[model samples]
Target: MEAESGKHIQKAEGTKLEQSSFEPSALSFQLKIGFDGKRAANNLTGLGNYSRSLIEHLAHQFPENQYLVYSPKVKSSKQIDAFFKLKNIELKLPLNGRFLWRSLNILKDLSRDEVKIYHGLSHEIPFAIQHTRIKSVVTIHDLIFLRFPRYFKYIDRKLYLLKSRYACKHANKIIAISEKTKADIVEFYKIDPDKIQVIYQSCDDSFKMPFNKETLSRIRATYKLPEKYILNVGTIEERKNLKLIVQALKEVNEAYKLVVIGKQTKYFKTVEKEIEKLGLKNRILFLKNIPFSDLPGIYQMASVFAYPSFYEGFGIPIIEALYSNVPVVAATGSCLEEAGGPDSLYVSPTDSTGLAAAINQILSSEQQQARMKKKGLEFVQKFNNPLVTQQLMDSYKALLNTANY
Candidate 1:
């Protein structure tokens, strides 16, 4: 009986496809969506995490819709392959060519697949898709290249402006990860504010779960973690403002230490110079190549999490700290307030003295620590996967309902 029902449904779907070829009005039915999965397939950073989380949550929440995940070059990664295990998702690769396909030929594949909607999980959409029947959405994570142009090379900044402007102007709807990013899109591109939607991203569920004492013990021993420390996670770069944290440490109690976990770059040398000049070699530790699975325990064990970045689209580490029941101290110049919530303390990005005071307050007062932890855990509940998934589905429905598609 199940097999018979499946056959009937397949036949009905075939009929719908035939009708949609000639009439886009047929889009009122179940959606066939295409996603630019380049970051999810290749990166392990913010963009990749956003892509994976969105695909996983969307597929779980709305299994009736068909999803095609396309990449410039389809390679097998354990992270990407896990998403393919979902019966509703298919891995689509470039059919025409390589470099040119990103800029030119992906539109042909979208047409061939008969996708009603295409979403660029990163900051780009194929230029040709705007002229076709497919409605498109682009997620612009940040306009950092424009905001912090000093950090970007000349050619990189120009290309970023060109592609981001094209996507903002041409796509059916835009998803900005935070209100800061949405405002930047309007200010930099001179695009209408009504065209953008602000959506929040959260840390993985691993941070929310309780860590086993044995696992925590193992991680502590492996890293030789100090009993009391402030933790910061991100690349050791100037923009992340690790130097501010190091300077703050000098003013704090001698028992407290700072542990940072990220890959070292040339910027680390500059950071090292500051640390040495301040005679803080014993007070700071930089952990390299830590396994992803161990991050939760690391967060849980910290006395406080410090995120002193000068700017960001959103600070994922702040939410991670909240979920791990650790209090947070973050810089004030960007979207850190949104990520840190009301319970977390904020200080100027450049004020090492203010940062020191904030960290001292958390470290000294047990009552303050407990109150911040409770409020933060409650705040992060709004970003749970189920809620975020429903919000995304609503956007998809809204885009498809528009008369333009």
Candidate 2:
């Protein structure tokens, strides 16, 4: 049956493909959609940002449709607060079983609410959702845990594999954030390619907007940022390969400092030990608890942005930096090429000298920076909010239109 489904598969480059236009006015009625809201409401990292941004854009673009976000609890943050203020979005919580509701019992509430489409914003959907009338869609962000097993605990890898395989097998449709992820799903889980749709995600709207010099200066003063620095963002973890950037700083110009912003993990000690060995304590600055609003200014003021992650489902920071008009130097082994586009420079993840050369190549030449900035801005427009939201809404409508459903 899965092989039969592969017959309808179409080739996709990143998220670009022929898609039917989404017109809310042409629709007979409004859509009542449900999403896995745990990350949207609580997580402060990549998954959370993806969830919040997608939901916000969908709401803004399709106000007539009803959005139901289900989560066990909500945390108060500037982003979350702003999300709640938007019209046409409602937060749903279980009356009880808050602990296991999402995994074990959320389907009951989904059925009761008559959610026409249920999207698991993260990987897994509730078990037995295939038996329900609600058409199910699951977004498989990445198979990083499977790709880089050494970075994760043995049990964690097993659990991730189990849940992801189950989701791919059961969900009526799958949304792959990148073409690479779509390929990984087919390769690892043996799922039908036709079952997956590539839909790129956009960064926060704040990154796309311009910040004035005064506002940038205020952010610089607040963070005590250096006059010139290279920026790297994402959780400081083994797979993120922050250590590579730390090593490359040895070869980069002494005048340019490296600013690291992220939630640190045990792997940070490994990077710190390398920093101590290299005697770069004064050359590196690590910032924590940065407000989301201030991130754009930080990126805008940077000399260059560096991301040497060993692997990713999709690299959001590359687009964020591109939108901020900063040239990017990202690692080459994974899907960074797709996110960075052809204009951004790439180096091997383990090549410290090459990475440093790429960074310096951008910083030392104004002409090079301007060209990359121009081309990157042009490439990133394909991931804009309206186009991405339309693709998503069209996916939902297409799923509902299927006669089998």
Candidate 3:
């Protein structure tokens, strides 16, 4: 949130090399950026990952600007200890400690702090602050509610549409995670294409580093993880299509089990019913609520990672699997290709036979697995921390340069 006398900054429309770099040490301008920290505080899901990673990188890579992260209540500061170590970033708690200050009172605080840029990490921006001088940016991760209406309750779907549409209409610029998301924004909300910028997200750096044998063995013993399994990590919901993977596993004649790591929803009952009907109890395993620190080991130990999600803004787990040196077999549709890369196997979303064939093909051959692993590692290099951090900083700089303060 650098305060400069400018009329307006337009959307960024250049490659990484084309943009001018802002020197972090010299800090030519004074920018104070405020972010909606609600998701970053209590959640460990995708939203939380996006918020925490972006904020941490901004503070680390661009130390010149000040950052304010506003949240209702922070579960524990220790979870994000690396972020707190940075002097330029501060987390502000709600005054009452009992209410979500975002809708009610966060605006007054932002105005008082004289924040120049307010970013809504989730699909929301404060309505009270929209007309003010503060320039706004909103990140819309996905339009899942709109894409799969039956998955969401009526009230939740309506609210998501309302908030997402309002934010898109009012924000100075929108950050879409992928081209698919950008297209959906334009189609669903009728927003101008020029107003949106697509920025791909990277998984945490921890995923890239190799885990030691002792730690892996401890986690496996603690969780009772199988030696060989097809890993799938995502929420257990209809749109995620976890049941399809289970169905496909039945046809594959291998000792490798299907290990799922995600929170279970009511829709999990549907999957459970299928599992019981098939009596494939020993073949399918669900590991819910595993510690985030242990996820890399889980991914590394898997025989092959399978993601049959119907759609996603960008699939972080696929990238995580790539970094872990695990071969991937994902669904064909949507942005999974961007995450899985060309070397990995792809099958139709609904075709169990196709999925089974792909899984079997990878498991049967050691040379194929090695080649895919090598290619996946090479392909995922673009999503490394330095590249993604630069892209994000460029977007922030572009927004600030084009806005009137």
Best lDDT among the predictions, by candidate number:
2
Q: Per-residue lDDT tens digits of candidate 1, residues 1-405?
A: 011100111111111011112222333327788898777656766788778778867766676677778776544445555555555656666655567776668888888878999999888999878899989999998999999999888999999889989999999999998999999999999889998998888788788897999999999999999998889999888789998998999998788899999988788988999999999999898898887779999999999999999999988888899999999999998999998898899999999999999999999999999999999999988777788788888998898888455
Candidate 3: which pairs clash? 1-31, 1-32, 2-30, 2-31, 8-402, 9-402, 9-403
- Candidate 2 residue spans exceeding 4 A from truth: 1-29
TM-score of each: 0.91, 0.91, 0.89
RMSD, every candidate, angstroms = 7.2, 8.5, 7.1
Instruction: List lDDT for all candidates, in order.
Output: 0.82, 0.86, 0.82
Backbone clash total, candidate 2: 0
lDDT of 3 by residue, 142-240 (tens): 998898888789999999998899999999889998888999999999999999998888888889999999999998999889878999999998888
lDDT of 3 at 252: 83
Error of 1 at 174 (Å): 0.6
Off by over 4 Å in 1: 1-29
Q: Per-residue lDDT tens digits of candidate 2, residues 1-405?
A: 011110211222322122225544455447799999989878877799789788878777777787788887777655565675554667787766677798868988898888989999989998888888889999999998888888888998998888889999999999999999999999999999999999998887789889998999999999999999999999999889999999999999999999999999999999999999999999999998898879999999998999999999999999999999999999988899999999999999999999999998998999999999999999999988899999999999899999354
lDDT of 2: 0.86
